[model samples]
Target: EGAVFIPASLAYLIGTNIFGPLAYKMGRSFSSGVVNAWNELSIPLAKKFEHLLAPNAGWGFAIGMVDSAMMPIMGHLVDLRHVSVYGSVYAIADVAFCLGFAIGSPAISGSIIQAIGFKWLMWVTAIVNMLYSPLMILLRNPSKKEEKEVSFNINIKILLTQSKIKE
Candidate 1:
């Protein structure tokens, strides 16, 4: 989405004489900072809210969607204004967003769970957004022996197939 939006927004800005490589650079930097902050906060937020809610829940997804929508808008804003001002504004917003995620997530989850119930939890989450979290429990890692066997089988198959094609 960032890839898609950055070019489009840049093109629009370029048409209006507002786009420059510096703008792109600043936007990319801002995006990296925002993503890093979100990832760092996610685990702590999940842990804090865990007792009140379940894993594989939609809260992370909700926050992700909001962040996604925000990035391109921020990019455009920085493109439209002076770099120092835009950077400062984005810094402030980033701080607010991080603080909000850190503080609000657990509080919100606890309140929702208390006021209603887990059923309402799913409903409230679903109504607000949608995202699928994979079940890690259903996954398995290959043993060392199994890994060697799979690699050997793949190599043998490739050799036989190549020899046959040479005929």
Candidate 2:
């Protein structure tokens, strides 16, 4: 455990320092997706070796890297929204994070491990993460101008519909 723990923590610090700045250069969505996908894909690959120091260390590093990148990307996503909705955005994010990470992941992973074992768990997780990665990479955060235009169009449509009803 110590072998894994020490390397993971050290790599986490390195990944945090590296990816935080890279997010600005590469765009948050793309950076986060690639990092996350790599992290997930690395697991099964590393697990294939089983009980080796090097592969496990690398797997731990990948885990640390993804975990480090996620928080900042989440914050960047919230920042894309309106200041008025900041509280709501953060509240929703916190709830999802808590539900998914704090509660759901552990419970689900534990069941998977019990049903099969660690080896299969890694593969299952990798498959799921790969399926989710495209969406994360492709999702666009609309610009402020686009948001205003959309809002205006909706308002106009509502007004027009109301006028037709009154007629």
Candidate 3:
């Protein structure tokens, strides 16, 4: 319990202190991509070193990090995409998560893990999570507004030069 608590506490603190602001600057889509990318890269090594870290605490701590980080970042995405209705969107999402937690059980997860095999289950989860990284492409980059201003200025300059040449 101590091991799980310590790691989980650390993860939450770091997520709140470090990742939260980073996410705000990077935008929800990019931050989520970075998080997933880092996880996909780190997970295999972490599994190999599982015993060294703590035998049974891995699942608890990892789940804690996921729970801490995923929810708010997703809320941020809803904020970006639907500025006016983000509150409603987040409320529905929160309710859905609560229902999932209420209905989901260790036995169900255990059965699925057994059927899929733990490694396979992990790999499949990684792949599915990785699928989200590409979804960042669909998101309008947060910097696009600044980029548009710069590009617009450049375009005007080019048009002026072209007109002068035509004269």
Candidate 4:
């Protein structure tokens, strides 16, 4: 457990740190596909670690990597769907995503997991998200200039600084 725990935590930290910034340049759906695809590797991992009583370092790490990357990707995904929002109207978009994440994730996950075991659930999730990603790329949604790109760095910068910078 100790071996698995440390490696998994480290992997999650690395994934979120690395992918959070990378997700900026890669765009939302693309980066999400990259992360979500990590679950497919778990099939091989499940085989590799089948003898172990608990999650081995590799299995834990792989799941950690995907799970960690998924966190920040959620924000990017919200922005993907709400790219053009700005000013007072941005609050609406923010609330919508927050509500969906806070309320919707549990609702969807419970039903899905009840029908499928954990391992198969991950595989299904991985395949479904990966399959749709290229379609999202092909069917680009047109929007205003705000939709084109967002500097997440600016948000980080604001948080670090004591004073807020006016945009």
Top candidate when judged by lDDT against the true structure: 2
lDDT of 1 by residue, 77-150 (tens): 55544453566667877998888778777777778778897566655454332222222111112122335767
Q: Rank the candidates by TM-score, best first.
A: 2, 3, 4, 1
- Please, what are the lDDT tens digits per residue for candidate 4 over residues 1-167? 34535654665566656655554455534545644456444543554444332333334444444444444544444565665434434465568757877886788778877888666777876788678767645423434346224567676676768455533
User: Compared with the true structure, what per-residue lDDT tens digits does model 2 show for residues 1-167?
Assistant: 45555655666667666756665555544444444445555555554334344544554545555555556555655666545445666677668867987777788878878999877776666666667756655434544434777889999999999999999
Q: Which TM-score value belongs to model 2?
A: 0.61
Question: What is the TM-score of each predicted model, taking all chains together?
Answer: 0.34, 0.61, 0.53, 0.45
State the C-alpha lDDT per candidate. 0.46, 0.60, 0.55, 0.54
State each model's C-alpha RMSD to the native: 18.9, 6.0, 9.1, 12.3
As for lDDT, the candidate ahead, 1 or 4, is 4
Highest TM-score scorer = 2
State in Å the error of residue 125, model 3.
0.3
- Whole-model lDDT, model 2: 0.60
